[model samples]
Target: MREDLRYLLSTFTARDRFLLVMVVLAQFTSALLDLVGIAVVFPLMQALTGASLEGGILGRLYDVLGGGSRERFTIVLALIMILAFLAKAVLASIILWWSSGIVVRLQTTTSRRLLQHYLTEPYLRHRDRNVGEVISAVGQGAQMAHTSVLGGLLQVLSQAMSIGLIAVFLLVVAPLPTLAAIAYFAIVVFGLQRALAPANRKAGLEAQNAAWASSHALVDSLHGFRELTMHDAQGFFVDRFDVANVSQAQSARRANFLAMLPKSVLELTTMAAIALLVILSVATGSEAAALPTLSLFVAASIRILPSMVALTATLGTIKVGRAGLEVVVRALQEALTSGVDDQDPRTTAALPVTEAPIEVQQVGFRYPGAGRDVLRDVTLRIPNGSSLALAGPSGSGKTTLVNIILGLIPPTSGSVTYGDVPVRQSDQWWHDVVAYVPQDVYVADDTLAGNIAFGVPEDQRDDELVRRSADRALLGDLLAELPDGLETRVGERGSRLSGGQRQRVGIARALYRQPQVLVLDEATSALDNETEHRMTETIRSLHGEITTIIVAHRLSTVRHARQLAFLADGRVEAVGTFNEVVSASPRFARLVALGQLDLQEGPESA
Candidate 1:
């Protein structure tokens, strides 16, 4: 628990820590006011009952208030008590409001930080982890930290302080009863902790895992909804989701039940302690004289009992949430130590707006935990403002090589350089000069102009530039058909647009950046022959204006390239012009023959 608290505190900023201290002070002040309110009850009761107030702090207060008649003294005491109670209530409300704000801020800050960490991580790191688990950590884990960790700790602190102060006052008035009550409460709490610790931990871990699994099930089902519907396999995903949902519900039920148990047990114990105190007063034959002290103790008990119950319940919640807290903390720690410096280079230096040839020399790569290299001593050079096509089998390291060129991942051996500078040394600059269009482009549910202008902020989006890029990608005709033109809203993942239109939107987005080099990784693979040819023509139009690298299985897509490279078994088999490579390598010749036949047959026949 101490370790968990330390980690929780580390999550807070200095300003937040300061606010927390203020909250504690406010709570302590409220508790003191409450104690004063309870202490005054004894004097007020004595005065009303016609008992003498000639001793103790109450007596001193009575003298200060000019005690003369019982009626007058009672009235003054009553007013004092009323005012104190009102003041305490007001302060308590303020404390509640302030703490609520802190919890909200904590949730937002943690979520944002976790998201930033995830975004800044390298591509390989993201591919290695489960997306659902990451989503849960960013969503549910942040909420738990606010509700279970920070909120629980604050509740425990405030209640414990109030309980402690009230107990001390009770001890001053009636030490024996107060000590007995403390001992009983301590025993109940300790025993409950010992008995429920294991179950609480188990529930917490199960809840976290189940939640992640449910999220994974939902995301998978939604992403593959088309396939499931076509194959009538929706029941399989439904059953998987149901199992996870049931487990999560069970864990939540168990946790809530355990949290409520403390209140029930404490209530019973409180009743017994009050009864015992009455019995002790009677047995001592001081029952008649102990009325004032009994009244004070009762008033203190009213506040202290609830404080004890709340403290116990909050402790239980913390126990159940510890597992989630650990997971969130671990993710934050990993992100902090990921060793990726993601600061904007524009802060220090600006990249030159010029084209440069990309050169790869003896580059090799092996995926983490893989037995063999994916790329072995692979080397190539792309000239400035010249098109190069990379044609290879599915597992021949084409995408991997592109990723290295894009500076998304580092090579295991040797290096990739641009204009005599290593890519790693100018990663940010490299990104600025290169634009990539994958086979399937991601389109947000936003306006056509927004999707075309992708990363540019709304206020900064240039309509002229968007139109120019759209025209360059051959999207002018589609835009003309739309009712709202640039303002048309593209459905989620561009569902509103045809596959060809979506690919064109992606090309327009890449062109919007006006990059010095454009990379297309089988970007036209899913289109029909007409769309494929049109997209290829669009690429050909860029010719000498942009350095283009094409990774394609379709021979027609790369036929116009000045140079072509063929890869096999993680090594470059041949690198030359189309006819040169086809003549030099039988493998290249065979692939071209197959590609041409597929294109001639049309996609339906292929």
Candidate 2:
């Protein structure tokens, strides 16, 4: 428990820790109030019977009320008790509200921070992790951490303090019964907790794993909807989902049952203690003398039993949520400790500079856990405002090279630099300078204008830029067809749009950035020949204005580029103008022939 708390605290900011300390202190104050409320009960009951007004709190009150008019004394005493109870209730409610707000706010902030962290995490970390797991950590993990971990711990502290204060009161009133009851309750609560500790730990882990598995299964099934529909393999994926979901459900059910067990056991024990105390008082022929003691014990029992039940439930919740809490804590820790520098570069303004060439100096890269490098000693230079086309066979590392040049992935050896600054060092300013159109564009369920503007907020979106970029990407026909034009919702993943339309949207989004460097990886693959040609022209128009890097799927896309590189394996075999590469390498010639391009036609010189 100490270690778990330390782990969680380490992930929290100084402000969070300070707020948590304040919450604990508030809980302590509430416990003291509870003790005061309970303490006033015994004397109040004695006053009601008019039996002992000459001792302790009752004596003090009697003297204060003039010790004369019995009715006045009773009425004033009752009001004092009522005030004590009201004070305790009010403070309890306030503390509950405050603590709840703190927990919920922390959860909201932590989840948002985690989402941002995962979105901006090092690309290598992303490649090595599952997307669904990241989602789980941000969603379910945050909920459990706040409720089961934070709320549960709070419950235990408050209840434990309440019980301790009540015990102290009982000791002052009647020490023997207090000692006996504490001994029995402690043994019972401890035994129950110890018995279920291992089971709770196991169930917590199982539930966490099963939840992640179910989420991953659901994501896979939905992502492969087209394939499943065509092959009638939906049942297989559903079965996997069912297995994971059932495991999660069963683990939760077991944990809940275990959590509730102690409540029932404590209730039974409480009733027994009440009955035994009564019987012993009668048996000892001391019913009259022990009436005050008996009342104190009974009131304390009523309070302690509930506190014990709450303590048990909280302990159970903490045990059950510990595993998920660990995942959440780690993600929060990662966000705090990510070596992206102490300051967030994403918010920094770009440096004022003229066109600068992108230089790839002996860059090499390998995926984590891979035996060999995918790119090795690869070097390329894209002169400012010039276009470079990448071409090769399927496994020729064309996309990998483009990604490196785009600053999406760091090289294992050497470096990629934008002008004088390393791309790694350039950070968000580099992202601002470059625009990318991937083969598979991610389209959100948003309006056409929103999609074109991409990450920019609606109020901040420039309508002129959207229309210009859309027109440049040849989206005029699609816009004309839409009833609402730019305002029309695209539906989830752009389901309302065709593959070619989606690609065009991707192109428009990239163009909207008005980047200094534009990279297209198979960006024209989905377009029909006429559209592809028009799109090629659109790209061609940007030449000698912004540096263009193209990883072409179709050989024809590179025919008119300023320069072309034919990559084989992970190395460039030939790099020159299209005609020059064709004459220089037989493989390049064969590819051009395969695409049915005129072998003798030469493009405009770079």
Candidate 1 lDDT tens digits, 1-606 = 667567767868899999999999999999898888888888776776667678877688789999787778888888888899899999999898889899888888778778777776788987787888888899887777678878888889999888888888878877887787788889988998888888888988888889899999999998898899999989999999999999999999999998888888888887887788789889999887888888887787787878888888888888888877887888777867875333543343466435778889999999999999999998899998888999888899999999998888899997988887787623577777889999888999999999999977899999999999999888888988999999999898888898878888889999999988999998888778987888887887787899999999888888778788998889999988777778788988898787663323221232
In model 2, where do residues sit more than 4 Å from their true spots? 55-57, 340-345
Query: Candidate 2 residues 425-462, lDDT tens each?
Result: 23777888889999999899999899999988899999
Cα lDDT for residue 237, model 2? 96
At residue 336, candidate 1 shows an lDDT of 70
Worst 10 residues of 2 by lDDT: 339-348
Pick by TM-score: which candidate is best?
2
Q: How many clashing pairs does model 1 include?
A: 0
Residue pairs clashing in model 2 are none
